[model samples]
Structure formats: C-alpha cells, structure tokens
Target chain A: MPALRLALHFIHRELRNRYLGSFSGGLWALFQPLIQLAVYSFVFVYVFKAKVPGANAPGYIPFLVMGLWPWNAFAEGLARATTAIQDNAALIGKVALPREVLVFSAVAANFLLQGIGFCAIVIAMRVFGVPVDLFALPLALLGFVQLFVLALGFAFLFAAVQVFVRDLSSALPQLLMLWMFSSPVFFARDALPERYRGWLDWNPFTYYTEFFRAALLGAGSFSLSSTLMALGVAVIVFTLGYAIFRRLNPYFEDFL
Target chain B: MQSPVLVEARRLGKTYPKVFHRRDRLRALYRLLTGGPGIDSTSVLRDVDLEVRAGQSLGLIGENGAGKSTLLKLIVGVLTPSSGEVHVHGRVGALLELGAGFHPEYTGRDNIALSAALYGLNADEARAKLPEIIDFADIGAYIDEPVKHYSSGMVVRLGFAIVAALRPDLLITDEVLAVGDESFQKKCVRWMEDYLDGGGTLILVSHSMYHVQKLCRQACWIKQGAVAASGDVFEVTQAYLAYQERKSAAQPVRQDSPSHAQEFYLIDLALNGDTADVPLVIDQGCRVGARVHVHSRDGREPVISFGVARADGTSVYGVSTEMEKQRPLRVSENVYTVEIEFPELALLPGSYLLRAHALDTEGVRLFNTLVRSITIRGESREFGLIRLKHSWPAANSETNVAP
Candidate 1:
C-alpha cells in the first residue's frame, strides 16, 4: 500500500474524471455491485433454494454477496487494468512516465469500490444474525494481498499485449466470463467432481473468493495452504510480468 | 560551473512514417494487410546536439518543417529518439501541450490533481498544493465545473498558473501563449519575466520576433531540418529574416488571374526602393518605385493603379491615376515601368506587401498584378508606434548629463 500511494492517488483522480458530470455522486461507486448482487441473489437463493456452504452462514443474502462480490471485484479490476495503457493512449504517448503507473491506478480504483461493497455486506450481517469475527479481520488482509498481486500480473500482461494486438480488448469479456464461472461463485467448490476440483485448485481466484467467504462467515475455518499457494502464484506471475513489461515498455509511445 | 548543465541532447533524431493511399482503397487494404512503409515517420530531425544550463533561456525558432516541435517532444521525452539519447537531470515539468493532462469531464480541481499526480505528486502532496494552484488559476466558481465548459483563455490561464505555482527546474514551453487576450498575454509576459528572474530556465518557441527579442537572450533559427543560425536573439532573427528575403526574391512571382481566355493581361509586378544600393528602414519612408511589363492587345494607353497592403494580404492604401485622357501611348509586348511615391510611412513594426493594378487610360478594366513579398523594418522602441520624431532632453532627465 505504501508503494501504491501514487498509484492510488491517480486512481482516485481517474474515478472523479470518469464520473465527473454524471450526477450519480458516491452512488456511482456502489451502483454496479448492488444491482448485480440483487439480481443473482434472486435467481439463486429464491429460485433455486440453494443453501449456504459455510458452517454459520448468516442467511441467503449475506451468503450470496460473499460469493459474487469477490468474483465481480476481480473481474472489474482485471478489465480496467487490462486496457489501462491502451485506453489512455493520449496520456501514455504524450505524457512522460512509466506507463505501468496507469494500469496499477486503474485496477486499484476499481478494487477500492469493491472493497466498499464488501464492507456493506459485513454491516448487513451484523444487523441480521451473523456475528463479526475479529480474528477473520487480519485474515481478510491476507486475501487483499493475493488480489493486489493478481491485478498487477493481469494488468501488466494485458497492457503490453493490447499495445500490439488490439483484439484482446474485444475478446476480454468472454475470457473474464469464463474465469467467473470457474471460481466458486454460484455453487460450492466441494460440489464439483474430484477431477474438476483440481481445476479450481490451480486457479488463483479460487483462493481469494473462498478465503473472502470464509473470513466473513467466521474464523478458524479459513485455509492457510490455499492462501499460501495464491501468494506463491502472485509472486511468480508478477515478477515475470514486470520483467516482460519493463523490457517492452520503452517503445510504447513509439507505436502509440 | 553554472548550475551543471541540466539538459543535454546529442545527435538526436526522430522520423515519422507517412501513410498514403492510391486511387483504389483496395491498395490501402493490401498495404494494411501486407504491412509496408507509409508516407509519415520520415526523418524530421537529424543529428541535433544541444546543451542547456540551468537558468539559461533558449529560443527555438524554425519553419513549419524544421522540426522544432519534434525536437521539443524529444527533449521532453514524449518522443524517444529514432537514434541517440537525451540526458536530462532533475525534474522536467514540460508545458509542451497546455492542459495536456486535463480530462474534459473532470473539474478544474480534479485536473490539477491529475496533473500533479502525473508530475509525481502523492495524493496528500497534491492536496497540499491545491489551494495555491486554485488561487493561481483564478477562474473562481468555474474551478468546480468541468474543464470542457472553460474557454480557451481560461484553460491556458489555469495551465500557466499551475506550472508557475509549482516551478520546476527546467520548464519547456511551446507556442501556447497566443491563446489568450492582450491583457492575459501581458500577464504571461510578466509571469515569465518573474519566473526567469527567480533563476528558472525557459525554452520558448514563438513565431513572433518581438517576443524573442524582448525575452530570449540566445536564439536558434532552424530551417530545412537544420540549424540556419544560432546566436544572440537579434542577430539570429535578422539572419532568419534576411534568409527569407533572399529566398523570396529568388522566386518568380506569378499573379493568379481568372483564366477565362481574356485579352492580354498583366503577368507580374515588383516594387523597389529608389535607393536599392543603400538600404533604409520603413520608418524613414523610402521612395518606393516599381517596374511593370505590360503586353497590350491594341494600340492604346493603359492607366494603372497600385496599392500598398498589410502583411495579411489586405490592401491598406491605394491610388490610381486617370485613364485614356492621353491615349494611344502604347506598346504590345515587353516590359514597362511604373513608379509611385510614399512621402511618409504609416505602419507599425512589421512587414508589408505591395500589390499593383492596371487599367486603360479611360479607366477601362485591363489587368491585375502579382504582389511582391516585401519586408519593412519599423522604428525601434526608442520611438513610438509611428515615427512621430523625438529628441533627447537637454539634461537627459535623471542622468544629469546635457548634450
């Protein structure tokens, strides 16, 4: 977070810049998650009568948020960061700086909005039945560590690739959609077949989403091995991604 | 040494490729699919080397294709050299494009933060400088409004104010000052003077020689992607001016007239001072004489009207003598001579053009003329706008020395 201070400032400026005259105010940040959560909760909890997978699941509402909230946050963060350099062609080409700053800022901004949505769910759980677990609070910090690294990796990869092959921009939504269903969003990860379960084990989002749900549900149930695996993957991907981006980053303005 | 040379560029060059299409769009498609060279990205700058010390101002002057702007981009690192390097020390806050970091949808307050962030300011640091920047920008209530609603002057003022408030070590400014009103331009001049007085370096590029002479101590005049002259401001400007004059005189001026197949018409007209051997300033009001070569259709005298025009191609003053009262004094082919008088010059410190018109002695329409590109240096600042004449005071005022 200390390293990302400049990045976060840029992110805050970017949010204000995009929504400046829209009249939605702070509602601009809360709108997308609220609507998406409401619609999916109706379809799954009401229509399908699905039960919460955790031991002390508050109710359908909190359970529904615990699943889709992280998925949506990761998806939006990746989307913004992926196109960050390409979308800001003017700033990238005209202004002199490290272009990675733009990508980090874009993803960081979307992550903050999603963070707010998660806080709302925690407040709702307190009002209803589920109690707040203080021990789970520190565990949630570990969740963000993974999310931050994942965002950096994807943003760096997409930003470099998008500069050359613009087709990535048009093809991203389909890719993100596929990634969303893979995470334990609408269904529990345990329900999948044993062989199919290995697929979620390797996917980094699995660790983050499951950890987020477990942290909000209660403490002691959170898995340490999965979070550790997530951190390892983040380290490898980010280091490789930064190496590639820095090597190719010099000529971005030339082609742009 | 003198602040240890803040910026240095050696053998810098940039080439932009050009894209062109044939009569068929399919050819464009073929090139697009095949990936071949286009019209742009041609080498605009070649082997340019420069050194800039802190607090040393340099004026960059050049023609449209001379690569002045391309060099600026390279210096600011907006562009990387096709080959070579630009070594810059300390922070470089480039005002290359005014409001370059501004988002149209964002308020002025937001854009200031955005620009500050681009300059490597943290959120808290940007917020700390916000009040000073807002006050300097001085648009009042409009600062809370989106920048799209701001006028060009407001945009320029805000941009200038921000840079001035957060003065960087080396400030690179392009020709952005021509955006505001007269008073605002004055304010900019004062601000620039103060900025320099505070030991800040400024590299300015402007089409106005008045500005260069008034501000820049050293100047570089570029032509044809090369340095034509570089030295003191006045000398470099004079060399640029003299080069333009020589090149213009080398061209054969062609008058573009209606080509509807009319009778014999005029082809070209030129004005020369009677004292061509000894040059004179326009303030002294030299005797302007002209030579006109007329090819007539029939044996008849043609009356001619001549004019002195402003530099913008608008005629300011004109005179025409009576026509055919003295008819039949004519010729068919070859050149003729026309002379005009200017007892006094009535212009300011700028260039002017001379255009001529020809008609029959009876004032019947005959021919139009080709205008010559002319240069007229005005009176020095010691005199007012026009050469109204002046004398030194007997005691020379505060000098306490009498002539």
Candidate 2:
C-alpha cells in the first residue's frame, strides 16, 4: 500500500512537472495531441494521399487518430520512462524508496495524459459524423491498458539500462521513431508489400495499433489469437523488464 | 530489560566500481547482469561492525575521506553493502546531505510532500504534518518558492524540519548541524535532545567533537575505511582528537632550531618526564609536571611561562615565574630550567595543549614557544574546561533536596 501510494504521489508529481510552467497548463495535454493529429492528417492525407487499404475503411482522419494517439503514448512514455532513473539520480541517491515507482510514474503519467487525449479525440470524431464506435470505447481502453503494460515493460528495461549506458537515452528518440514507422502508426499493415506485412507482426506495437484501429474505428477485424499473443507478450515483457529492474535496482546508486 | 537493537551490522562493506570510461560501464553492466566477477572497483568501506540499541545515540567521527558518510548511507539503506550485511529496524529518517533528495526546481512545499511520500506517509498524514514542517522550517514565504532560489541555510532548515516532523524511529544525520545559523542550530540541538529524551535512537556523523560529546554516549572513530577506535564517547573522541593533533603537529614547525641570537630561546620542554612529539594521555586529576629549559643569549635571567589551552586555542590557565616571584634555576652558563607541577589537574576530559614560553626578565616580550598536546581521559558529565571544586550541602539535608 505504501509503494502504491508512493507511486501515485510520483505520478501526480510527474503530471504536474509536465504542465507546471506551461501557459495553457493541462489543456496542452489535450491540445498537443490534437495539433499533432492535425499536422499528420495534413501531411499524410493532403500531401501523400495516403488511404486505408479497404473498401469500407474509416475516414483517413479517424483511422490516423486511432493509431497516432496510442503511438504517441507508447513512444513518449518509453522516452520519458527510459530517463526516469537517470533524471532522478539526485533523489535516487539520497532517498531510499522503491525505484520502480519512478519508472512506473513516468510511463503512467504519459499514458494517462495521452489516454485522455485518445478518448477525447475519439468522441470528437464521433460527434463529427465519422462513425467511431462509441459503444466499444471501454473495449478500446482495454487495448490501451495492454499497450500500457507493454510500454511499462520497455520502460523498466530501458530505465535500468540507461543508468549504466548513458547513450541509450540520447539514442532513444531516433529508435522510437524507427519503431513508429516500422509499425502501422501512419500506414496500414496491408498497405505494406505482402512479404513485409508479416514482419509487422514481430513489432510489439503492431498489435496495439491494429487493435485500436479495429476496436475504435472499425477499420480492421480482431482475431482472438492475436489478442492472446499480445497478452502473452505483455505479460512476458513485463515480467522480464521488472526482473531486470529488480536485479539492477540495488546497483543503480553505485553507477550513478 | 535491555532495549532492542535498532541497528546491527556484521562486517559491513561497500565498494564502488571504477568506471572511468564508457566501455567500462558497459563491461560492468554485463558483469552485473551475468553474475560474473566484480569489475575493477575501489572499496570505500570494509569490515565495519556496529550495533546501536533503541534510545542510544552513536556519533561517527572521521576525516573528510574516512568513509563515515558511506557508513551512514549503508545503514540508511541508500547504498547496498558489497561484502557484509546491515539491518536497520523501524523507520529511518535520514538527512545524508544538505538539501538531499530535494528537486531544485520544485518549491519547498512540494518537496515536503515528496519527502513525506518517500518516508511512506500517506497523503492525509503528510497534509496533517505540513503546517508543522513549514513552521519548523521558518523560511517565511520561501516555502512556496522553488528551492533553487533558496540559500544553503534555507535548504538545511527545510531538510531538518521535514525530518523532525517525521519523528522516525531512528534518526540518522550527517553534519546537518554545521550549516544552520546560531539560533537554528540551538533549536535543532534542543530538538535532538528532546528526541533522544523521548527514547528515540540516533546515529550522527559530525566533525564537531563538541556536538558529538554533548549528544552521543558512544562514538566510533573511522579512519581510512576502518574503525580506528570505538567505545565511550569521551574516550573515542579524545583518541580521535589526539590523532588529529598529531597529524597537524606532523607538519613542519615554523620556528627555526634553537638560536641564541634572540634574547631568550627555549632549549626543551618536558611533560611528566616525557619529551616526545606525540600527545600524553592521562586520567583526570593526575599530577602533571612540566619542565622548561631556556637559553639566554645574555647572562640575564629569563622569565619562563607555562600555559594550558584547549585544543581549539581557548586559554584555560597561564602562569609566569615572574607572577609567582619565582626564578628559574641556572643549570649552566646560558641554560636555565624551570620546573612546575600541578599536584591535581582540574581540567576536564578533552584534548588540551601544554605550552612553554621564554620571555624577557620582565615577562614583557615573548621570545620562543614550544607546544605539546595533552589529552585528558575520564568519564564525567561535568561541563566546562576545568571542573570547579564544589560541595552539595543540600544532599546532607533531606528536606532541602526535592522529594
């Protein structure tokens, strides 16, 4: 219970840290995603003439919104959580607490904000006659939760490693970018050549983006096997990441 | 009944990996992951055994790089032991460094919440103690301002205030008293005394032997990653002070070799028949005999003076042969010896300097000086430099004493 309380405190602190000095405050959490959605919609729909590869595909804006919000949460969460321990070296050195709380709060704070933005944008698309599945929002949140677990796994792994290898945080942005493009964040998996389409399944993020599109926008069909696979991957990654974190936890102060 | 042991360590040790290059970090990471042999490392602390019971206070005394801080960190669980084990029971409130665990960008109020959380206080409990902590910190409006803009003293005040409010089972502090202002320091010392009186435990690391002696009943002297001495507060601190005095005296003396060109110069000074550079450790109330041999450039008799001063240079007692209308015995043509003895030394237990000076016949001008360190070893709760002889007449009358 204390660890849970500490984690919540840190999550609150993290959320405040993001919007403390900003002009628009927590509104930026909602507006930042909206603006990003606008820009991506412009560049991909208006400029590249990109489209969903199906006859009854949802509008390009809704499809993009469904995937981009989750991708932003995953990428941004990983980026912030990777530096969680390194950024808090001062706190870690002086105070004795569960170090996992720091990484958890970072990833959780990002997911919370983007999760809110994802729901808000979905409802907005529904109001604009885009035919978003309003009744399936809770189901979509389950997929979002699954993605959160996956991101937390990577967060733990990267946060521990970043304490030793300082270059991981520096190189994480480019790596997340490559990971984003490799998944179906901007383009559909079917849009990839037939041979390369199978490779998309290897990226852990591929299931979440495709799942969110299938759940919220009704663009793709959901498969039970894929859901089971995603659940297994999340659990395995979480266990492994947490195991590594616990192993490296005691040594973090030494390295820092 | 004996109190429970609040802290127990068995041959505790800590070492930091020597990561000079990026490649070494990777290698160390690999070694840690694979449970391989340790990477190249420097051991800061090793084989330190310590035990402290509930309601007992222990002072850790050491030089700058002497591993006292590392020992504190290890006990506080901020650092893991590399070789041995340390177990601390109950909640520990630690102020390891000035403004430790404080985010510079966060306001003092916010940091208080963070610290409370780190100490495992729930939100309601933290809220309940907020006003008390802020009041104790007494930084005025700076509580709401970011800690970055506060002075070092403010940071220490805030840190101490939070720890005080926590009222943890065991309080471990490292030199936090040295930073506060005079009144705040008095307040903190008073608070610590009260905390201890309430049966709280304490482990303090400080260079101030005075504070250590005042607050702690036991002391551990660490030297170069090892326990040089550990025992009674008075004894260990005296030993530590003697060691420090010897270290400082080991430096080259400024005075040139005995030169007869001056009007008066000292030939030698002996204490209790011993003439050596190391300090003489003696029990309190022991007879102390001093002999000063002076060289006179001229045949004129010179005045010899002896003075006892606390190690910090506060003069305790000084006397001149001229003051007592006594003259030195002329042992030779130019050499004179003055012997003085205190049948019962009244000085309390602490380190003091015994100085011998040669001055003009009138005792107007000092010519040469020689200093020797003397450490008084005893167990007494008595205060001040010299223990004044007094009698408590009220003890004989039952009515006069409080029931």
Highest lDDT, which number?
2
For candidate 2, the TM-score is 0.94
- Give a tens-digit lDDT track for model 2, residues B1-403: 9999999999999899998887999998898999999788999999999999999999999999999999998998889999999999999999989897998889999999989989989989999999999999999999999999999999999999999999999999999889999999999999999999999999999988879988999999999999999989988987888788778679834554666588889988899988776777899999999998888888789998999999888999999999999999999988899999999999998889898988999889988889888888888778789999898865676776678
- Model 2 - which docking category? medium
Q: Any runs in candidate 1 off by more than 4 Å, and if so which?
A: A1-6, A17-24, A49-64, A213-225, B1-3, B16-41, B120-140, B222-228, B238-289, B293-311, B314-336, B340-352, B359-366, B375-389, B394-403
List model 2 lDDT by residue over A142-169, tens digit each. 9989999999999999999999999998
**Which residue pairs overlap in candidate 2's backbone?**
none
* Model 1 C-alpha lDDT per residue in residues A146-169, reported as the tens digit of each score: 787877887788777666556777
Q: What local distance difference test score does each model get? A: 0.70, 0.91
Residue ranges of candidate 2 with Cα displaced over 4 Å? B246-256, B321-329, B360-366, B389-403
Give DockQ for candidates 1 onward, in order: 0.34, 0.76
Worst ten in a row by lDDT for model 1 chain A: A218-227
